[model samples]
Target chain A: MNVPLLQVRNLTHSFLEGEEKVHALRGVSFNANQGEITSIIGPSGCGKSTLMYLLGLLDQPDSGEIIINNNSISKLNEIQKTQLRNEKIGFIFQFHFLIKELSARENVALPAIKKGEDSEDALERADQILNQLGLSEKLDRFANKLSGGEQQRVAIARALINSPSLILADEPTGNLDTANSEIVFDLLQRLSREQNLAVLLVTHNNQLARRCDRFISMNDGLIVD
Target chain B: MTMSLIGIIFGISFFIVTQAQTSGFQTYFIRTILGTNGAIRISDRFQDMKGTVNKISKDGQFKFQFKSREDAEYIDGVDYPGKIRNALSEFPSINGISEVFECNAALQTKSRNYSVQAHGIRINDHMIASEIENQLMHGSIENFLSDEMGIFIGNRVAERLNLHVNDRVNIVGKKGNFQLRVSGIFETGVSEIDKKRIYISLATARSIEGKRFGGSVFQLSMFNPDNARSVASQIQQTLGHRTVSWQEREKVWLDVFKALRISSAITVSTILLLSGLGMFNVFAIMVIEKTRDVAILRSIGFEPKDISAIFLWQGMIVLIAGIVGGVLFGVIGTYLVSQIPLEIRGIFTTDSFVVNWDISHYIWAILIATIFVSIASWIPARRASKVEPAKIIRETI
Candidate 1:
């Protein structure tokens, strides 16, 4: 009975939209375990990104308990949340937000550098990770020169550089064409399986969602299935 | 960023070089002028009766047309030296005073007659200790005290007459021709003084002028030369004589130097102010343009302080480079400025430009640049730090 990698209990959130309180989430609860990919599918305004933001410790929930590694996060301040975000979680976005000026390897090394690792060691680790992801030849290419699939793979390498237990990827393949989407999905699947890491992916692609180990569907901010 | 660095470099170099040159020129000009001119001079009113007669009438012509009559003769000098010497104690800044007799005479050599202005100074009165000491090229003022017939000749006059220390020359005075020995030769740097002036003992001047009491002028030196005007005014009121300060005697040159000082200050200040503003503009635009990157950096676990440091380091890099480059360029510019030959001919003289190599100016430039650049950079850095990562990431990114 190992502790769950990420836990959310009775999560709720709202926003002020034109003088009206719009509830985004209501009592949404779930657990993502280690070594499993959890797929969350929803349409626009379904609060999937909001849930991702909350679970990543990017925003505090209106009412809920988020526990990472069995340590409660509801009471953490911004500094503590930043430290936790740096050490315990990884993030990937739909657009593959890599700094365009940096090389692929340097992009991957940033998180490790921010975590107080020596730059040389961080860069060496980045080189190893990029090599493992089959970007060995393209390690020195700037992010803008890489194709959609290559850029997304580089983002995955950056996310794995710090060795976090859980990854929150919001629509990781939303902008990719079908062939490249399949290739990136396959790569994520292989990496998740091989690394024994948990991934909570928010997406609208049902075919890819069904490939995950666990599925959670949402509409209007509430869990449907 | 490069523009900002350039601005700072020019600003700092301009400040240092301008101040150094200004100080040097001012010192040189003041020394040249004060070498021959006393800080304050009290000369007897030679034209009092003549001026009154002309002012009361029109051009000394009494419209009343007085019939021919005899007039009493009057001497044109201070006949009471003891009375004036007692009045000088009222000046708090007075350091030394000497009576000088001035008259136009012809220096008669074997085959030449050169008209020269003779200044008769007391060699033992300590007046030459400061004023003439800077201009002494050969022999000493004490030579005049030892030899009653000794005279100090200007280097130019010496060159003209082929005269040296212990050489004898005859001067044709008002009533008689007196033979004199050259005791010392001084070069006052000004062409007027070096070419036409000579110094003799006051006792000899009185004997030649047939006076038993006083000379025409009382030359006074002060510990602080800047106190001349006020001291002149006070003494003029108390002693009833025509008093003149060195500032008034060379008003044109002094006013020009003051204007130069003011213009240099304004120019340097404007340059530094604009440089600081340029730095501010550069960093502000940098922060604004990098909004998306700020969000991305924040999302990657960079705190507000770290983000701010990125911008601060950028500004500091420019500042450090600018300071070092500016100082190097300033020293070189100062040296180059010093090499330029100056051709000023009238009151002041210098062969090449003088540059005061002052270390304090360099320290001052660095300190002021640091303050300006830090303020210019800090505002933008604080702005960068307060950037809301969530808003930019969600909306803009």
Candidate 2:
């Protein structure tokens, strides 16, 4: 196949601890194809999150080449990195992290607003997305007023506001109950298929990982297929 | 937020009161001088004239004539002969006509003789000054008119001359030596005039020079002190003679105002700078505390301009709110304070000094100070726009 949508090669990352050295990621590599749901699973401290951060361009690897859409983004400047991230990537965090001051619809429309969309249009789109997530009635509710699952849904709507091509979820369902977790996982899978987006989700749940098209297990700092 | 706004309001109010006090002093000075002297003085243009101001000789006299054919005919037939006669006859009749002449006097002090200001004051003119008169410490002004050689002196002059009321003083003028009795003293709160000048009745100034109702100068008073300048000019035009308004007559107050302006500007700038620094700290802290929010905004696609605009709008809101609260409190507080008796008000007045705050100064103070604060808030707002989304998000999370 042509180059994967995202490719990581020989990614190595480490940190210093006083006199000691701690290696977080060691020359690991992974390729995630377009329009596929790829999950990365590992225990805590195995550097799974670190690898994901590097791949997401939220952190840099000491030695690695990260290619997105067949362009090696390892050399991109901060402005270019931010531009690419804003234009092509979306993130879903376990905490939701919706701004407390804004209403549910405003939280969801935030990304669209950042993209310079008209406020009314962004609000309309946010309402539409919230409705799809069964949150139409809570559009005006403040973020703090929402339930955990409702808040997570609002966050998902925010991530989708720019219609980004790739979605990165880090334990998106970590704080939810089994039922809410299943529901959120199901929604993520459905959104990937509906929007034809490439999704990479990191989770400790074997069941959630199994639902993706493919799963890569990380041990220590290396990925095992 | 309201408490913070209150703080800002208090700051603005302090500034307003300070400015009002200073401006009040200035207004008080101007009014005191204008009240003591004539609202306008039509004088001769001497080296001391400075600008359009003219100083008529102190002995200058005034007389009134009517604008009527018969009266004009009588006046020309009796008083003026030649060209003045023909002109007087040509006019139908003229009211407020005055023929002024000069009386030069050389004042003898213990050390030397110096030129002293003298005025020819008629009974009506004497009454005008008498209305504003206060204790002069020695002689009565009525004594000045009792004898052509007599003159009135103020407390300041009595102190300086080493003489008391009714004391004999010798005056050597162009007309010759005349010993005069000290007359009723008058004090108008003008230290310079009180100490340096003496007053004489129109009859005395005219008589000493062997003259009857003729002076080279005339001082004019207007219905409104505020419009004295314009009226004086109109009178000058009407009489076809030069004139000087109160402002032109007294330039010391103008210099005083200029100095006051500089000092006031310095005072205002210091207050504004303090408030601005306070606002800056507030804005900087707000920005620093909201770093994560700024990152969130940036991640969501907020341009730097948008971020700046939000803060700018917030600052503007704060400014407007503070100014409104400040002005409301300042005006009301000053009014309430002014209503109290001076003795009671002295409690707040420092060292027994009280300045009744004027409303106009209070309003202007808030406006100017708030504009300074708004400008001060811009620096932090600009710094806020430089916040990094990725760095803030990663670090904060």
B1-397: candidate 2 lDDT, tens digit per residue? 4544666677667666655655655565666666556565444322222233334556774343323211121111112212332332343322122223346675565655655555555534445533334434555445654566667665566666666666777666666556777776666556666665667765566666666632345444444567766766665445433456777776776677668766866765566566667777888998998887787666545667778887888888878888888888776665555454543211011222235556666666666766766776788889889886655665554
Q: What is the Å distance of residue A73 in model 1 from its true position?
A: 3.5
Q: Count the backbone clashes (under 3 Å) in each candidate.
A: 0, 24
What TM-score would chain A of each candidate receive against the reference chain A?
A: 0.95, 0.94
**Could you tell me which 10 consecutive residues in candidate 2 chain B have the lowest summed lDDT?**
B69-78
Which digits, one per residue and each the tens of the lDDT, describe model 2 over residues A33-64?
76678999988877776766666666677998
Model 1 chain B lDDT-worst window of ten: B65-74
Per-model C-alpha lDDT, please? Answer: 0.82, 0.68
Fraction of native contacts in model 2? Answer: 0.25
Off by over 4 Å in 1: A10-23, A60-63, A186-196, B33-128, B131-134, B137-146, B155-178, B190-197, B202-259
- Candidate 2 segments exceeding 4 Å error: A1-3, A12-23, A54-57, A60-63, A71-80, A219-221, B31-117, B120-292, B302-313, B328-397
Q: Estimate each model's TM-score.
A: 0.76, 0.62
Question: Each predicted complex: what DockQ?
Answer: 0.32, 0.19
